[model samples]
Target: MAARSVLVAGGGIAGTAAALGLHKAGYDVTVVEAHPDTAEDIGAFLTLASNGMRALAELDATDAVTAVGFPLTVLRLLDDRGTEMAHGPLGAADDPALRYRCLLRGELNAALQAEAVRRGILLRHGARLTSVTDAPDGVTAHFADGTTLTAALLVGADGLNSTVRRTAVAPRTQPRYAGQHVYYGYTDGHTHAATDGPPTPPDTRAITMVRGSGAAFGYAVSPAGRTYWFARVAGDPLPVGGPGHRTARALLPLLRKDPTPAAGIVEACAGPVMVTNATEMPLGTPWHTGRVLLIGDAAHAASPATGQGASMALEDAVVLAKALRDSPDPHTAFARYEHHRRPRVEHNITVSGALSRGTRTTPADRGDDDTLTAQLAWDTPLPAAPGEHA
Candidate 1:
């Protein structure tokens, strides 16, 4: 039998992972990305929980990911004064190798894209989807490049502002601003002077979270003496040409007032600072309809407070591909994918909102808790996809 042809929209984490997974399941997969280059990582660092590592392992890309990333052991919560408040374990307890992995968002995307290309999956750059039309049996995607492709299935792995979501899924479905924003940048530890206090152990790789009056800071040392840091502050959505465009030096003063070492991190930053409005898609009932399906941020976007946004996208890709590999029909497969993933994604969404709210208050008022770490860890094993053997 001829393999089913799948046209995936978006070439980010979810899109690339889905392309790889579907190809592994005996389907011909092609990914279309709007960006001129899909391999470039556009965001900051992100933690891949144990579950996400397992999903990458299933796709045979874990080692590639770990090669460029660092392993994080514990997540430490502190106050504005850098006083220890609470700590919690990261990753699944049973597997030491599966502990949380942190890497540049670009590196992760590059690794995944390399792996997918090596597996013979086709990826087309600069092919933005202009619109999508559903037919009786398949869906036709119209691209801005004046190209059209029809396939057995179309996967909307595009991101929060997914064009496929608007054209294929419910046109009414939309993403809402979560009323929080984050500033992130990276700096080289080797280039900066260490704080005068007691030096942390060389082997220490714990992620530190410090709660300020109305903001929160998180940072961890990555491999090669690099510091990855982010600061979350409560504010209305940024207006056009707002402080986000301010120079690193300009923003440093605002963040330095906090008692934590955010000032030091800012002073050491060697790259451009990024400010993003944290947003979440209002939970919609059914993530799919007919021959077209949505996955990743396109379907259900969540705040980064829970740190499961990337992991959830990985999980969604694997499950959706598995559903296609196992189910007797496309409709059935889409239904199964939505059913299995909705509960978990929804839970993350709720918990993320709660944590985001907590960031608005002082850490002392929040009290000592491992809520973030617990929410970040995925203890249960993901159900094996059809092609993956137990």
Candidate 2:
């Protein structure tokens, strides 16, 4: 019942994962990326939670994941002077069976991308989706390079500013700017950024939250043992956009205060620091069209604070591919995909928003602190494991 072919627009973690999943289901898949090329260094650290690991497991790439990433066993919260306020195990330290697998975004991306290539998935870089036409038989994607191809279904797995999203759906409005901004980058490890000072405090693989009265900073150690830091200040992305250096100059006025870990990390960024934007996709309505469907950031952009953006996207790929494998007709498959994924995706969007909005408090103090239940439902089971969900 799988579709004959699928076209996944965008080559990021979401799009490539979808392409690989669909291809493994016996459907011919092609992935089109707007980026001209790819590199080993993506320049950002990512926390996988338990949910992300289960997704990678489905691809049977956990070994590769283990090679590059680390396990998160505990979370520590500290104040400006390195005073511990809250500390807890990441549910894994207590039970070694529990897996809160965390890794670098680049490392995971490389694993997924390599698996996709090994499976004969057609990978294209520098191919921008210009338009999409869903016909009675199949969907066709028109690219900026004056080329076109047809497939049984099309997936708009593109991220924010997604061209696929704009052409296929109701064309959701520009993302509303989140009121705060951040500066994030990766370090070789937990090396102190304060002019070669002592190690930073409350450091762990668990996603660390350095909270304050009106603002907060959230960050953690990535899989590669390199530290990742983000300082969330009350502002928006700097207007000037060229490179990270220029943006940092403009944001200097906005990020003057050293609030806890934010102050420490900012001094340590050592490399180029860019202004970060906190924005949300209004939850694009009608996430589907004739033969086109949306997934990942194109359908809904999860706030980084919730840390479920990648998890939800991976789930979308699994659910959508399962629907296609179960239904005979592409339309029926598309319908089933929407029916099963709609509620879950919407709730996640809301949860991510609420988490970001309430960042100034500890997880227990936050009104919408349902991280425990949220984690279980979101994590997909590892196929190799006898019994596991997330």
Candidate 3:
């Protein structure tokens, strides 16, 4: 029998990783992306925890990603008084391939896309998805440029504000503000001095988080001496159509209230300080209908507080692929995938949202690591859905 053709919408981290997984499962996968090129949102950076790395390992694409990003081995926490409160090794720090990695969002997307292309998967840039038509036999994707493609399955890996989810899956569901405004920027550490002391070099391999009086701040220095920093402040959502480019000075007042290094890092930023409202999808939103299914942010997007957005999406790719590869049919695959993923991703959404809203004081315990390891293991057979035979 001919391999089933699959259509994947959006070509960012989630979409590309899903394409890799589906192709590996013997599906004829084609990816459609609205962006004209791979280099979009280059300024935004994120950390992929060890679990995300393990997912990449299952897809055999670990080297492609680790090549571009620097590993973070240690996590340090500081109080509002600039005093160190806790320090420890980051997730799986001893395992080079599974260590936490900090990467620019665009670079990571490009790396995954490149790996998919290298594996002979069809990837089309500038292919904007306008709507989806799900028929009994197959699903059809209509593009903005007056083109269409039909396939046995449609996977929506688009980020927040996914077209597939809005038009097809659940029309009423919308992303909600998670009670915080996120700001991030980069500064040349070589040119900036600490607020309380002379020019001190940054800890290259350590990511420092500050519990400031004004905002929650984090920073990681690259090996090249550039400081990548972000601050999340609890506030009303930025007014729609407000200024996109904010000055670092506007945020300095908040940072200065605490004696931490956040203020100095913002002050030294020579470029525009980028700001975005932390947002998340509503819990229990539908993820599939007929031949169409949603993955990544389209299905479950949590706030940035836990720093697990990309990692969660990577996990989605691996699990979804395993479900399809092992299940008897696509419907069973979708059901089993959701059964396995909903609990974990929803837990993240709840915890991260609480952290963003200041409703949670301490970090909640993430469920068993061993179970997740087995779930993402490519060779391990995915467990059957409730009411299904083993």
Candidate 4:
């Protein structure tokens, strides 16, 4: 039989990574992105945890990603008074390839997209998906520019505001605020310094998390003496439209109250501070209907408290491809994929939501590390779904 043809919606981290995985799984994958180009949300930065790195390795795109970002091997915790509370190795810190990595969201997206294109995957930019038609035979994607493409399956890897999820899977579902406003910014230590404040710590590969009285703050200094930091403060959601042009100055007061370097870093920020309301999808939202299925943020978006959004998306790509490659048909593949994914991602959403809402003090122990390691291993066969023969 001929290789199955799959159409993936959205060209961000999740979508592009899905293309890479599907192509590697011996499928004819075509990626359609609404954006005119690869550049997007240049201000935001994120860390891909160890599990995400393992997923990238399974897709054979680790080098493509590792080349752009800096590694983070240690995690440090500090109290509101700038006192060190605890410190330890980050995820898979012993392995260079599997260690945590930090980089601009746009850079990571560009790297994945470029790698996909280089591997002969058909990636069409500016192909905005206006709607989707999932017939019994196949699924057809309708573009805003009056173009249409039919494929055996459609994967929605679009971000939080995914058109595919809203139009096709769950029209009534909506993302709810996770009870905090997140602010992130960058400051160059070489040029910017706190005039009278306490001296900021030297640049290390460690990500420092501050337990403030009013907000949760974290920062990591790059190898080049640049600091990337974020603060999550309890607040009402931003205006319904979006995070307007908010500056870092608004956070100075809260940071200063904690006696930490967070305030100084914000004061010395080199450019505009970006802010967004932490949002997550409701549990039990439908992920698929017939030949169309949702993955990544479109299916399950958690708050930034866990820092697992990108990692979860990357994991989604690899597992979805594996399910399709191993299953007898699309229906089995979607079922297997959901069976394996829903529990883990939903746990993240619940934990992160609680943390954001101040209902939880610490993340629960994830006892599934070994199981996850096996699942992301490319050479390892995926486990059969419950009540199905292996």
lDDT by residue (tens digit), candidate 4, 1-390: 133999999999999999998998899999999888877788889999988898898899999999997999998888878787989988889999899999999999999999999999999999989899988888899988898999989999888998999889899999999999999888887432233445655646799888998889988888888888899999899887668446787788887887777777788887887889999999998999999999998999999999998998999999998899899488888989999999999999999999999999788755229888888888787887897653
In terms of TM-score, how similar is model 1 to the real structure? 0.86
Instruction: Provide backbone clash counts, one per model.
Output: 1, 1, 0, 0
Point out the higher-scoring one by lDDT: 1 or 2.
Answer: 1
lDDT of 2 by residue, 162-195 (tens): 7777876757555655555555665554544332
Model 4 misplaced regions, further than 4 Å = 1-3, 190-201
After superposition, candidate 3 runs with Cα above 4 Å error: 1-3, 190-194, 197-199, 365-368
For model 3, which pairs clash?
Answer: none
Candidates by TM-score, descending order: 3, 4, 1, 2
List residue ranges in candidate 2 displaced over 4 A.
1-3, 79-81, 91-98, 188-205, 213-215, 222-225, 240-259, 358-390
User: How should the candidates be ordered by lDDT, best one leading?
Assistant: 3, 4, 1, 2
Model 1 lDDT at residue 138: 81
Error at 369, model 4, angstroms:
0.9
- Candidate 4 matches the true fold with a TM-score of 0.96
Candidate 1: which stretches are off by over 4 Å? 1-3, 39-43, 93-96, 190-204, 240-246, 249-254, 359-390
Q: The CA-based lDDT of model 3 is what?
A: 0.89
Residue 119 lDDT in candidate 3: 97
Alpha-carbon lDDT, every model: 0.73, 0.64, 0.89, 0.87
The best candidate in terms of lDDT: 3
